[model samples]
Target chain A: MNEKLHPFHIMILIYMNQTGVVIMSLPHLLAENFGYNGWLGVILISLVVNLNIFIISIVYRLGKGKSIFQIMESSLPRVITFPIYMILIGVWSMTGCMVIKNYVYIYQIMSYNTTHAMLLKLLIDIIAYLLIIKGIYTISKAATSFFWITSWMLLLQLFFIKDFEWARLTPFLFKGDTHFLTGGFIVFTAFLGYELCFMLFPYADNPKKFIKSVYKGNLITTLTYLIFCLICFGFYSFEQIRNMMYPLLDLLSYIRLPFIERIENLLFGFFLFTTIVSVVLYSWSAQETFARIVPKANKKVLAFIILTFGYIVAWFPDTLSEVGQWLQYLGYAELGVAFGLPLLLILILVIHKGAKPS
Target chain B: MRTMPKAAALLLVIVIIAGCGDQRILEKQGFIQSTGYDLNGTKNDEKDNRLMITVDIPKSDPEQRMQRETLTAIAHSSKEAKILFAGQTELSLVSGQLRSTLFGVSLAKTGIWKHIDTLVRDPSISQRVKIVVVNGRAHDLLVRDYPQHPRAGQYIDRMLEKESALMSFPLVTIYDFSRDYFDDGIEPIAPIIRENKKNISFDGIALFKKDRYITKIESKQSLIFSMMKQNFKKGEISMKLGDGSKKQEYLLFSSVISNRNVKVKRSTKGNFNIQINIVVKGSVLEYSGSHELSKDYDRKKIEKRMAEYIENEAAALMATMQKHNVDSLGIGRNVRNSLSYEEWNKLDWNKEYPDADIRISARIVIKDFGKFK
Candidate 1:
């Protein structure tokens, strides 16, 4: 309990979570939703996400450095807080499980087609469980190393510069679009992981430093999304990007080094580290929520039980589309939590302040 | 002691399930190095089946007399053909290492998106695989044995790679093919290869409208096409100058570097007036002209003449493209940039392309006339 997270660790944790399996399909989604020069819309989406981050910061300032559980339990009775905690555990664990399940399903399509997806999911679950049992401080520490392992893939975008064409991006802005509302929601989900920082209010060495790091984390995620979407738009035609299921994977497949070709297979595996950080971070959050209900239980045992539940739930979605449909619902629910939690906490803080004057 | 027995059983189960996944062993799997697609037969053939898929798999054993094995099968679709191909060999045919996919002129002229879609859809195939348009039947090019070359597949792959560097043809891959095909402003193009007397040769560049081949730019004009297509650091261009009455002179430019710009302006006539300017810099390796290199006056004279020659040739090439109603140079892309999105969408580019006023101008800079002054 004495070990607190550094601001840098918090920044990386937010980044790794925001940049999971979604990156591979993000360009295609943008192309489908916003049409020509859809990448320009990422800046707008990032700005909006910053506003959401502002709300989370307000909760931090209002709650006065208290842990989320302390602030919530003090305001609401056990009857109200307990059901909220259960809902949080359900949504958080399923979101973590589906993120990995979607990744393994795509991995199956890429290389291990005949392998049982459940087996691969179990393998990833075991890695997540090991990391989750270590607790938040270790997970954040491991995330910094995981960030290094995957961030170099960004440099690969430079190879595409020779073929990237400004003309291919087209002059039209937001033309040929079909679904702006849904597209905005999907893109907003790309910045979903930063909200987990709320749980870290108590763990942060200083609330002021934590809030600043949250903005920096969101900024980094925005830059990563912009770089990827812009390169995809320039490297491919508008129609080509829309048609592709995973433009990032296809882009990686195009890269040819003297020693190797089809580097995507290996590079995509490196993403497992980053995704493991994300899944573990989410599982840790769920386990923290679970501990509130069973206060006397050991933390590691609760984490194991939560992960076992995740493993069982992950088995339900057998195909990629089915998993995607499940992720759509979870992503929206998580986004709701991301915005809803901070707003509710702020409302509670305001009401408490008003009643204290009486 | 009790836990030891349980752990042993769990590990054994894990090991057994691990082996159950699809394992593509190198020796057991036939790594398809190159593939060819041709029309099954003449159009009049009674059977409705239309695809003839040929694949070249390099033989692994050095002791074998043949360098590669070529297999051909006729079926309704490529996947069906793949199954037939697999039945003929002990190794399961796979496309992970597929280096190239060749389409016969016959098939390319009709349309090629169906086969290309299959290539793009398969997760195993690399997008960098060279896409080619064979001048004759793709089957003949795949099956032919050249006396001094490696296997036909490897030879063509190497040829395409080398020729691409020479700027003799555009190095279109599966990615580029589909990318351009999907772009509304421009069409896709691929290098054409033909089975020659002793070996294969770079035939030309096949221009495509959508996914169907429209016309071709010959090998000689391919350099001109390259100059207009994109900027290059190394290439060679040889031109014969002078009218028939005067003695003709030859000028060979090597180590060529060039940059091109397309400018589109809306004229008073309510149409796009496009100007294509190309700036070329290279050393003249050979000049049979009477102009003396040491003299500034003669150098200017030759430069002007060379520039004029390039301009004329480029204008002629543009005419060929316009006549064929193909915008392979991506003039539509330039025009699109100059207009609003709604205007571009409303305009029929193909209908407008042939009537557009396009002009070509060149500027030539000779760095060195050779090792001599």
Candidate 2:
């Protein structure tokens, strides 16, 4: 593989994964746990995750230019390495499918009455197939273009400032310590994408710049999610947000554009594109992880097969509420794979030194 | 080179597929301007909880010039009724355009959290929708013909906005209602809309203990309640001063603005004392007196009168709300946030709130009068 793609490309991929699905869903999940202080939890989680990313990047740089997979393979047996790689790939693919499914559910609820569940699954599979066929660099390029375009929509939230109630965020600290831990865990899930750095570590043209790119990407996503959470908390009270199935969509509905009556429709349209980019990048990364493990397998064909399987998994969730609950469980499992495994691998690598590649 | 045609063909297919999923214009589907929930007396027995929902659909044709056409359906649940109503209507019943929701006296008294939960859960309905308590039946409020506004929903929405601005009622949106419904301490209140001749006026605000409208605060007192609780940019306060001839004058003042600061302090004895500071600015729009007052009136006398009037109004509003056991002012919320839930529970707010020492201090500064001499 040619080391032509910069660490900036890795940053774009991570940014796409974090922003698209998490921003839309985090407020509701946080509200369920922390009530009104959900936005505060988002801020806390972002700060914590960025610190984790910084620490992880330092650890990666310490390992010279070798990827986490290489470090893990050298540190552990091939049996453990193969299973860990497969599990990591599975987590990414599941998360990708969940993101696509969530966007489709939002679209069906907001825009069209007759939007078939199968349509979104098919769309995800098609995009994944095309991106995989073109190779990982093409997918990274598409993500980079999307990152630039969607950065503007972050500004559109300013229009809703008038409706924000600062009083809703009152009594900042919880009455009890229990709420903080529960809320912290939920918000931590929103920052799960930063761990993508582990997989994309080898693709960075400049491995030394990996820390810089990861910090920049994580910072952007953190700030964006914080703003989104604040806007949601400001608009809907703690209880209203908890009751709402799709709190972000509800928040957008309150925003009446000067000319356009429904702002959620426009948001839903833009979100569809971002959601596609998010799922495609995740699926492509998952396919790449699989390709690395089995050198004999064709990457494109494997990508298609995995994406089709993901579509089936996504389609199986019966209702919108069920899909959301399933995603929470998936998020917990992905969090373990994304952060837990890497931390463990980094710890093991520190204990045992790796031999130089011939 | 061989894959170029296949890529082009694939791009063409993507474009075609994308074109198939374009957005649906909301106006094309019949938009529901407002929804009214009422108890269906005819449908079920006392044990059965049946609700009839009246949806106001705007007539599309300008020439038709109809105020509004309503479709009513009774079902076991709101979602069921909405679905049933959709089947009855000619156009798709779009809930996004919904501006207000009215609950009938009976329906409101029965509690509306179940109905509100349905409204909030539905993705189509917006959180900003104004929720109000109708004086009479919700169906009558929706179905009755009005001369002023073309649509009943528009009429009710405009009336609520006007009253809320005038400091007659605290602005109660669907979001606010839902917040109060779930909060342990704070109770919610919705403006009560009633018909007078051909037009509608906000006569009072319906106070909700949870989702039920437990009590009502009439027009003048509702103003005082609003002023004490909410920030107002514009309003009017008229005072009848003195007796005939010696009656110096009755002042009709407009352009009234007020900012109230409420502080809750726990006394050394463990009881709470509330201190209210009302900073007011207004113009004497009309003064029927012998003295030809300039742009600036006797500052001392105006200030004294303003303080007296505000104090009297505030006291009366508080007394009225207490008499009815309606804590719509969120005194309970202040207490809960100030103290623990266990502590708040031990001291019955309904009993203690009225007895709590409420000291009000008013500061008035006259900004302007419309070119008066």
Candidate 3:
């Protein structure tokens, strides 16, 4: 079943998950830290992130057909694998919830002024459940289709080129090196979902092609993110972009289409599509992690259980601002799971001289 | 077979939901085409900072004319003033189609930045809306109707676009005003509108020293001021030139394209000197005499003559602006952006701006003319 997904499909899935919420919020976050040169910080972060992908690909290749979870399970004790998997599942589910909540909040802000919040939550929950039921291959196909949709939507951003002011990107390197370094770290956290590929290594039809997929995915995601950052920088001044909460949405709101009075609504739907794909991919990873931990557990049942739990977790945050605060904390925690866990797992695999190639 | 029914139901439901979102809310919501704010002074034995707000909404007519209505609300805050207008007008003031926000001279003098902030922060209000200051009362600009246009909002909007396009005034949007208001080095300039004989036109540009309207630059000077700051698609300059025999010739040259480059350098006297280089690509439309030599005239001679004329005009304009303490040319911004903080503080930009040696140079390359040379 996993063999059906082409390397391109996997690349689209990974790119969508990494680029969605991160691109929408990173400009505002980096601007708050670095002020005028926040965009420069984003460029530096993209470079570092691409380098990090190279390192991760090296680590994944060193594992030799063993997925990160499998390597962790074999290299470490059963006691450690179960607990670590549980923690990983919890973090993934929380990340999924945050993405859904953020996307829903944006939808509500742009579209339904009078619609009940519960109805929107219910709609998102039902959609997530249906996608989860359809399984990983179907989700990958959906993500592949969405890749084109996102590209076309991105092309519409050219209308705002007339308003682009190069002066807004000026006072280059103004906030100094320390601010840039710190902002880069914050931006690095935004690209956290790249490690999802490490978990899906065993499922890949041609595991040899995993490195190529990861590099292509990272390149596409980085380029897309840079385009968004450039648009935000172009549409608004440095101070205005810095002050904005969701610079992407704010930038979209400024775009006026002839037939579509509010382009933000259409943009909101496109972003929501990406967000849903991201959540589904992460949730599937979490569910599979749980299934691997419990040998007797049914994978389908576990998927359903995890999807329901994710819905409950998403409901915990009553308001958008609270969800944002939770996501910030979750982002910090993801640093450990996304970066530290892989490094540790890779280190242990090397120490034990884990499984050679078939 | 059972799943077939379920899938069909789902598809039907999706189609129905998609069809339900077809309401033209903006049209029904009575779009506030333009808004005006005025200081109504204290009223009724209360120290109420009264505000008069005018909302222009599309009139319910076959002709699609706009109905202009004014609501007087006594409130200490602009937000309250807006809410009061909502109560009086009985229509939710939708700002999505808002063309411009006019501020009366009195209100502008009292510092209307806080009021403007309320409009800027509202997500519903558009940032592209033009912001202007009225020379007389804001109500006059909003209330007066043109026989041709009918709607005051549409009239003011077209007038602003025409004047800005003609290179007579700077196009100042709400976003531009807000950005300049926040930025320290740059000052905001908005078109000032006035009503005379039931017709409206751009009176001048109200120059703001931060939030306060400090001075006004009337028509032709506004053009010269904008020329220094912005690139124009088309501009015309009529110059009076003398022949070798002292016979004067009037040359009408229309610029097809123009670019201005401003550079600020710290002088040895611890002050700043600005150098302006203007490159123009234009065609000679008309000349006083039959001095047609050829299509390819002396490019160097034309450049020199045009350069001298532009330099004198630019220097005079800069001197006049310096006298009025208007830094609309963004000299301070250039200094702050290009220099370090310590170096910027050492030079008093406001004091040195007027007396600073403004050297101007123009390079006019004639592109083409009509049928005549």
Maximum-TM-score candidate: 1
Better of 1 and 3 by TM-score: 1
lDDT of 3 by residue, B1-373 (tens): 5865796687568646744644444434667788788887633534546677776766554564435554555676767766777777656666667778889997898788887777676666666778889998887667766786757878788878876776776778877887777555667888887888858777888888777888887765565566677677876767776546867767777865888887878767766777888888888777664455253455456556666766677778777667878787776677777776556556577777677777777777767656764
Off by over 4 Å in 1: A354-358, B1-20, B46-49
Evaluated at residue B175, the lDDT of candidate 3 is 77
Lowest-sum lDDT 10-residue window in model 2 chain A: A169-178
Instruction: Give candidate 2's whole-model lDDT.
Output: 0.74
lDDT of 2 by residue, A1-358 (tens): 7845687787777777677665676777777776547667766777888767866775576666677767776768888878877887787788888877877776777655565767756765675677766776787788888777777888878867776756555554433223677567666777777776776766778867777888888877877877888887766666666766667776677666657666677766777656777677678778877877887998777887778778888878878777777777777887677667657866876687533463
Question: Any runs in candidate 2 off by more than 4 Å, and if so which?
Answer: A1-12, A35-38, A47-51, A72-80, A176-185, A296-298, A343-358, B1-28, B42-49, B62-67, B74-76, B83-89, B161-171, B242-245, B295-297, B340-348
Off by over 4 Å in 3: A2-4, A174-182, A257-261, A294-300, A356-358, B1-28, B42-48, B61-72, B237-251, B287-307, B340-355, B365-369
Tens-digit lDDT track for model 1 on A1-358?
8999999988888888788898889899898988889988889888888898899888888778777787787779999999899999999999999999999998888887888888888878866876888888888889999998888988999989999999888889999865788989987777788889998888998667998998898889989989889999999999999899999889889899999889888988988987887799889999999999999999989998988888899888888999998988898999889888888888888888622221
- The DockQ-based CAPRI class assigned to model 2 is acceptable
Task: Rank candidates by TM-score, best first.
Answer: 1, 3, 2
Which consecutive 10 residues in model 1 chain B have the weakest lDDT in total?
A: B3-12
> Clashing pairs in model 2?
none
Candidate 2 TM-score, C-alpha based = 0.89
DockQ of 3: 0.37
Model 3 chain A lowest lDDT segment of ten: A172-181
* Candidate ranking (lDDT, best to worst): 1, 2, 3
